[model samples]
Target chain A: MRADGVLGMLDRWGRSALPGATLLFFVLLTLAPLRAPYLSGALPLLPALVVFQFSLATPERLPGPLLLIMGILLDLLLGGPGAPVGVSALGFVLIRAAVVNNRRYLVGVPFLFQWFGFCLLALGFVALVWFFTALWTWTAIDPLPALMQYAVVIVIYPLLAPLLARVRARDPLNVPDASRGTARPGETTS
Target chain B: MAIRDDFEVVASQVRTAVQRFALGLLVIAAFGAMLLGKADTVLVEHARVLALDLASPVLEAIARPVAAANRVIADLKEFASLREENARLREENVRLLAWQTAARRLENENERMRGLANFREGPEASFITARIVGDSVSAYVRGALLNVGRKAGVASGQAVVTGEGLAGRIAEVGENRARVLFVTDVNSRLPVVIERTRERAILAGDNSPQLRLTLLQSVAGVQRGDRIVTSGHGGSFPVGIPVGEVVETGEGSVRVRPFADFSRLEFVRVVDYGVTGLVGSGGPAAPAAPPAGVRVR
Candidate 1:
């Protein structure tokens, strides 16, 4: 009985850690140096997609502090040659806050609707980065790269979203499907 | 039931308030990081280096397979163009043969002149080769992370080059990794002279494919296809290293196409030319001498 209980505890721990681990995986994937032309510019969008999907599907799993840590980790791993240390962290925090607050409207929605919402979020995210980078460097950077990245991210959303949804579905500890009009597992309906 | 409900409501209120406070604090911390990074303080540099060192292993492991796949794809592309490439090479070989003969004659004359003038050769440069583990190529930044660092005698301010020409210089160094600031980065600036006219100018990168030739003393003398080479005016780079070729000359603007291909770089050589004092102050007390059995040419 004790062994079974220990195993169950471990299983719960692993399940609970899944979302954060997936986020970190996406962060590493984004930072991986794939030499394809213009692919590096578009790769940073992968983590942004993961963050958005998680916030919408399971906001409690990915809390504000966890998002902040992942974002800062990304900024650090990108090294000094890219944007300053906190730029990505800032972007991630704002993205989670935005998506979680709007989760009610976003959940249970048609895939296309979620995608449209993501498009807006992505634009705002990219613009925030571009603006912060410009202000940090004190120069009018070329907007073409930012625009190209945004376009690529938008194009790639449909392909990556379903994969993220699959991960969310696999989580045994996941809250009740919000689209089904049920309250989340821990919430009091009153 | 009523007492339990009241306690639950209080707990929920506390949780929400705590979450909001944490979010606000994180937002403030992010802004603080940006400021610290902008200040470019020692603490920030240390953090950046530490982050790079920690990530290098993972980056290298991931890069290997991607590099292999890239090679296979490149080979496939090259195989497709084999016949056309062979034909082009044959034509170029014939043209180059004639130039080779002329160059041989010039070399002989130059040797005699140098002998007569008693020209002394400069110190031979030593270099360490490093494979690129990470490429942070974005619209705003063009930089790379190398797998070699201080342990291998790599240091900041050393000129990095690929087979073609000058790529960039070392910007930061850790125990086992270093960051390269590419020549096409917006922060890159080099003093160069036109090879044809020997006119001096400053080569500046604006985060674009083509670099701009600024501070030209004789703009009228520059034309299409003029080669640009390092002037070594700033003591950061050695003199006479090939930089780029003029691609366009317009009203008050001239563009030079860099010889180094930034997108396709895999390995680079960090050359110690024995010149220092331009970039960061930290380096080996003695110049990095080439290890034994390594050629120093």
Candidate 2:
């Protein structure tokens, strides 16, 4: 029974290994140099996609602790003026938990709820985290531009979300095993 | 049976708590690493250097093809609008032709009288041209990397200029890549002289397009349309390089309209101001030019 809890968490996330590939894609893309000579205020949010993936499929896998670590790693790796990753990651955790825990009301709902929720969560995470951390770093006054740039991330979300959903559907881990006595509730198969 | 269930629940709670504590420590550790690297740490510097080195090749590989594709798309779009573009170009050409005539006359006159003036007294500067291959990926940073670096005979403190005027100076140097801290960065400061009055002031940027001239004791002496030039106070930049023109703002602070077009910087010159003076290996005396006895009548 004890093994089941740990194994259940693994089984849930292990289903869509696509998040791992997506994370790598984003990190490399972010680390990769731009092909132009002008600055781009827009940044592709690979981490936010990770949040959405786990939120929709395996909420238990993306625990509070992992989100926090991912956030810190982001801050360190990106090395922005402020430590924004921490709060953003926390936002992801809270948003995911709220949506998953309240999945009953949202059941049988169309994709719009998921899309809108993810955008708000991602934007709010970027804004709140960037706003506060920037304040700490004495550069907090520039929130307007940050918000505008985050809107770009939101605009690109709907397009990216469905593709991720398709990838998640094809994962073998998402396949239901009826023989595992009393399949856990709310685990969607198909 | 009840006691056994209680024990299991307590054990799981402890495990969760332990995991949380470890994560907390990791967060603190990351913060510590940032603070430790506040000023000149090898690890942070090494990582930055490695990132630049790694990204440059990627940038170089993609830059040409992307630019070419953009050009092709632009050409296709312009084909539908060529008639309008042609009219604009013709008008621009007429204006440029008039300016070209005046420019040619000035150049001839200046060259004829150049031998008699201070032209022979100043140290000559030479530069290597480089292309801007990549832009700052991080939003807070106001700089870009060029393919030229220390290994390419580039050095720190070398001033980079576009065709219009001074762009910025090389801040960091890796093997094949160097970062240029633009004049619009908060930390950037340049000693500039107003060409009209020869009044010296420090031009500083706060990551804004409008750069302020600091330490202006008498605002009355400075006026709009005054040309700014490098004062050569810090020796980082060459004297008389065109900086920008002054514009008076309503806030009572003077802003400079940068001569270089930051929006469309493509090719730049890396002024390799010879480091002979810095390294104590002063080169041989400047090559003597036969005295130009020509005097302007």
Candidate 3:
């Protein structure tokens, strides 16, 4: 293969592979030593890591059904009570699909919107898992603690979003050509 | 040309259908695994143990430094008030000595009563001290793993307590460590009787700091300030240990405030109930004999 072809293949592979690897990193982070048992902070939103990666790199690579499968796999790996990751990933895919075309929304929106979106998805995800687990285990777990954890995630997003941006590609919102010229408000045509 | 072009369009459509069908199968399998995992059969247990074992070293490496720093900070915090603390301790020591004298007299009277009642034997007990190595990973359960295990004379069903009162029981034991299910864990249920009133009830933890007292035959005699003690009816925990104080919630429900402080859990004494001899064969169980400096009487 030509050098560009080799580089292109590598780029394609990296785009496809990096998200899964990062999710695994988050898994390990949950497995990291802290006050809480089980890396719950890392586990619940793991599907977001996968979804965000796919949306940024290859927006339509994973079909809706495939995204559902990815979520299911994440759910099992996370070892929670139910399809939290599955349901959340599907939610992300739907959101991404809905927003990908609206250049104005994607580019015009502030990072805070993204952060809030993540927060809502996380809250919904934890609630789903807690509900199913409580039903199956025949035990009621208070949602208050999980909500407290979600609050922590929301607080940390500013730090995390910038870091993830550096590690991955530039914000698709920033690059009109990159995200199919969908740059939103306050962005230059360049 | 017409036939060939028709087949090409249909070929892609069929392939898409097959791919979608396979994806459906994958989702079902993954979801099935989650539901089926509830059984907690030997396979799941083994996987959890293996995962924990693999993950323990990493957790320990992180927890060790955090625990050490916490201890140092605690020491520094205590240093600021050491003079006042010492003064209080000295005064408390004198009071405790007087209390001890009375306690000894009561013990003698209790022994006399037991003899009068013709009780065949006293409770056989041995204990080993261990350190809390880690905490449970789930929010739904309150638990801790201790460093001592079957190799160190630690066994399942052993009562883990502090000097003050009942802590919990040894749920699962491994070669060198054991998992202790706290008295505050959701699954914990122990036979208990209110110390002041002798009202029997089940002490159960529902992932709360206070354990609920359920199935009480009568609340007439049980009060908010009543002391709760292990009934030892279940043959797990030894009888007469201070468990908690009864806290009466509204609507006839009550819970016990556990005596042990779980947040700063440092050391625990694991009691080995020599039940094999005391209940059955009538011989000294394990440890051969009690260690010196510790007198049963």
Candidate 4:
């Protein structure tokens, strides 16, 4: 086989794993030591941000299964009294749902508009997490953390938006393929 | 070619419909997961342990370079202050040595008195040194991840500390990693005693740098700058471990600045005082909350 063909095979597999890998990166960052006491009020919602970035930019690359899996992964990693299980995953899906539908309009707007859009989506994300936690624990989840997390997400979105823009532009997974043409359970004749 | 274009359009519509359906199902699944988590804690606990076990190695890998970089920075700062620090340390050492002798005599007298009274120990403690791999210094939760875990017999409720003072207790222990709930976590409720007055209070964390001394027997007579130490009320922590000093003493609000610098934490000692059954029965619950009477911060 030609070297290009072998390389192409490797590229395809990498592309297949890219969405999962990207979501995982956000999960890993959640554990980084940022010991600033003031900053502790709101942990950065990196997974939600990543999901929003991708779903807006490349919906086909990020399918529902991967989104759900990444959310579950985040919940499992961060589960305890600190955060309710499945909250982050649900937050990610919520962000994806919001972003994917309005992506076309968001794609052409100025960077600031996009940033604001993300901030809005991130607020909903935090709210989703807060809602789930409140429901499960039978206590009103403290709104301070959720509020702080949203503030941080908004403050840092501009700095991160460019990176997300670059990823959307260059993501191999975003390439049109069978992923976009995926059929439902059974619809051979249309 | 026309047929192919028509097929593409049909496929796109089908894909969109399927994707929306999948999203709906995922929302349900996420809700289901939370419901299951609330209904069945055992499964969540297992998953938490497994996730932490898997995360430990990755956290270690992530911390290596960052730790090295931090050391480089620390070395530079130490070098910058070497002469002044050395002189200060020498004077402090002389003072500490004199106090050490006095402490030994006091310890002897206390042991003799306790022996006469037939006092039983709370829980014998042993410590394991570990690295701070990751920490979430966020608005809601103050958690520190340690590189050492179950392999080192590190368990939840073990007091994590530094040379400076008491940091927090282990909240969750994985196979090779443990998350330390800083004394400043909103959920942290420590049973502490004022060293000078012997007044007992619950040093609770409200997600701040300083812990609030809640459930105080009397806000009165608690002087400013008073030393606070673990009372070992529940036996999870060893008694007399320096927790913090009174930093604020308003009538309604009192706070203690924790001895440990949680923000700059790197390495720590996870001391399991063997309160095994007293509190934290191999679970994430911290020592019982102080009986209700004091106002929360």
Candidate 5:
């Protein structure tokens, strides 16, 4: 009985850690040297997508600290010589804050509505990073690349959303609205 | 049951408060890190190098299959253009053969003059070929992470190049990985000379595809198609390494397009010319003496 209990505890812990692990995988994926010009530029958006999806779907699984760590890892990996560290971390934190603040409006919304919300959030995120980077570098950086990044993120969101939803559904502890300690009209604890 | 419900509500409220507090702290911490990094602190560089060393192996492992797939795609592309490419190469080879003869004649004359002047030769450059395992994800930064480092004798300030021309210079070196700050990075600055006019200038990257030629003494002599090569002023890079060519000569802002394609870099040779007067923050370790019988020009 004790062994079974320990196994169950381990399984629960693993399930809880899945979202963070997925984020980490996306972080590494972003850093992979794809060598294709457009794909290389578009890869950085993967982690942001994961952060947004998890923040809205399961904020508790991906807490602030995990996002902080993921952001730092990205900054370190992507921060070249004289590039400011923690800018990515800052971006990730702001993304989570924006999503969590509007979670009530976004959680049960239609997919198109959620995607529209993401477009605004992503634009804001890109602009924030661009502004902070320009301030840090003290130069008028070109805005075209940032805009391109935003476009790619917006285009990719709807396609990646269903995949993220599937991953969330497979989580053993993800009991719809039950673990959130609140149930909507349509969602009920099994 | 009423007491339990009240306790649960209080606990949830406390949790929410804690999360908000933690988020605020993380934002502040990130700002602190950015400031610390901008200050160019050694602590931050060391931490970055440590992170790079830890992550390089996994990145390298992941890059292999992608590289293979890329190669296959490249092969298909090449096959499609094989006829035109072959015709162009054949024409180019014939032209190069004539240039090769002239180059050989000039080499003989230069050698004779050097012997007559008893010119001292600099140490021959050694190369360490490294595979590019990763690249900067942020558009703000222009750099690449190479899969060679201190273990492979890749020190900071070595000139990284491709067969075409100078790509960039080594910025940070770790135990098993190193970062190359591309010539198009905002932080990169190199002294170069216009080949046609011999006018010197500072080649600066503004995080754009084309590098800006700043600090030029004579912009009047600059024109389109002027070749820019390193002047070897800072002792960080060797003399006469091809950097780029003047593509645009706008008013007060000249743009030079780099010869080495930063987007498609796969393998780069890190050249150690034994000159170690790197000019930047956290400069390379104390300059090693030129080996016996070898003198820096």
Candidate 6:
């Protein structure tokens, strides 16, 4: 019975493994207080890039609440009165909404167009951040920090794209190979 | 078959709508947490501690090799400049010796004065030095994480200083790690006095390189070269730690350039000193508890 249960759990894990792993990896990266600067304060939005990639192509895979939780974790690490978390979570939801709506235009597009689209998404992210910061401090501290973050994200996303693509490809491809000839009685097997 | 297809279509629609509804709820919850946190900081402080305790262990483990590599790189760089650094330090040592002699005379005078006044003795402050593991990711508020935590008896509001001068204070502590709120962070407000004129002012951080000195008694006498140190009005930092210098003083405005190089910080000593009059203060390290409803926000 225990073996059957373990096997069942494995099967469930198998079906959505790649997207799950990708999301988990990025969320942890977001939570981790890891800072490296191409320049001082030029932190790349690693989690944002990951969310943008999957939210368009596979919105079902990267759940909205999971993204919100990631933002909360970010808030906790970022050390504020939770304003960054709300702003970031709102940013994630808007990105998911935008990407989901524009999926048809976005899905099979050239890398350049997707990159341009990501620019728009990142702008929203940056703007939300600046807006909340201004509200909190009652004065806009500095725009350079936010701009640097934008510049670094744009520079880093292309490098991360191929890796994200590889992760996205593995699971869906594996489903067919691993589940070959194991047709369920009622389901039209893919 | 047609009926089954229709049912599947309805099921998928329902699933989509449910997911959308859940997303909306999460967004609302996120905003609520933010708003509530703004209203009450104690909850936010608790959350920060909990999150750090959970994350810092893993971060500490990960940061070990990276920190070691950073040390090696720094050592290599230092080695290349060994002769220049050695000579510079020797010269500075010669300069400080004269100041040290003067300082000893002042110390003796102050002790005699205190004895004449019958001053009550305060608890002696202790120091716990910890290596900074990494810079914080959040741009909202400036912070740096340390490897040693509550396991090392690090607590919030403990002054974190480097060999150079004052760095900041422990804002949040975890089990095996802590986050130092730098002197340049927006939330940092230190009660500081001008070293030359003895004029008192509040040194406030605006998330910039130069800290702002506000609430000044009179900016009229302040000049560019004046030194600044803590007035020790607040019960957090002890009296007379060298904080920074007056870099810019304008009409009704003054800015300080911190003596410590915050950007290049690698390690700092968390000093536990009695700040709050030692009146009804608990044991040595644990800071005096916030009064019934007056915890610093």
Highest TM-score: give the candidate number: 1
Looking at model 3, the pairs that clash are A30-A39, A37-B137, A38-B137, A107-A184, A108-A184, A108-A185, A176-A181
Which lDDT tens digits does candidate 2 get at residues A1-190? 2326877778655554445546544544443344332224455355666676556665544565565555544443454333333444455555565666555443335777766676666766666656645654565344555566577667767777677667666544443233234545434443
TM-score of structure candidate 4 = 0.81
lDDT of 1 by residue, B143-218 (tens): 8888888777787888998888999889889988889988888888888899989888899988888899999976
| Pairs that collide, model 5 | none
Off by over 4 Å in 5: A1-10, A172-190, B1-8, B276-297
User: Could you give candidate 5's per-residue lDDT for residues A32-149 as a string of tens digits?
Assistant: 8776656678777778888888887777888877887788888787775655678788888888898988876677778888898888888877887788778877788889887887
List pairs with backbone clashes in candidate 6. Answer: none
Worst 10 residues of 6 chain A by lDDT: A171-180
lDDT of 3 by residue, B112-138 (tens): 999899877646677788776666534
Model 3 residue B197 CA deviation (Å) reads 1.3
lDDT of 6 by residue, A53-86 (tens): 8775567666777777766776677674334446
User: Ten residues in a row with the worst lDDT in model 5 chain B?
Assistant: B288-297
Q: For residues B1-297, could you state the per-residue lDDT of candidate 6 as single tens digits?
A: 999999999998998798778867877887886687678877778887887777765666666665566567667878999999999999999999999999999999999999999998646776777777657744556778887776666678889888877888888777667888888888888988888888888988877778999998777889898889988786767788999988887888788999998656766888878553355456443443223322121
Pairs of colliding residues, candidate 1: none
DockQ of 1: 0.56
Q: What local lDDT does model 2 show for residue B185? A: 67
Q: Per-prediction DockQ, in order?
A: 0.56, 0.19, 0.15, 0.42, 0.65, 0.39
Candidate 2: Cα lDDT at B103: 99
Q: Give residue B229's lDDT in candidate 3 (0 to 100).
A: 92
The per-candidate count of clashes, in order, stands at 0, 0, 7, 9, 0, 0
Ranked by DockQ, the better of candidates 2 and 5 is 5
Q: After superposition, how far is residue B90 of candidate 4 from its true place, in Å?
A: 6.5
TM-score list, all predictions: 0.90, 0.73, 0.69, 0.81, 0.89, 0.81
RMSD of each: 4.0, 8.0, 7.3, 8.3, 4.9, 6.2
- Candidate 1 chain A: worst 10 consecutive residues by lDDT? A181-190
Number of the predicted model whose DockQ against the real structure is largest: 5
Candidate 3 interface RMSD value = 5.8
Error of 5 at B217 (Å): 1.4
Q: Which stretches of candidate 3 lie over 4 Å from their true place?
A: A1-109, A159-190, B1-27, B72-94, B108-119, B276-297
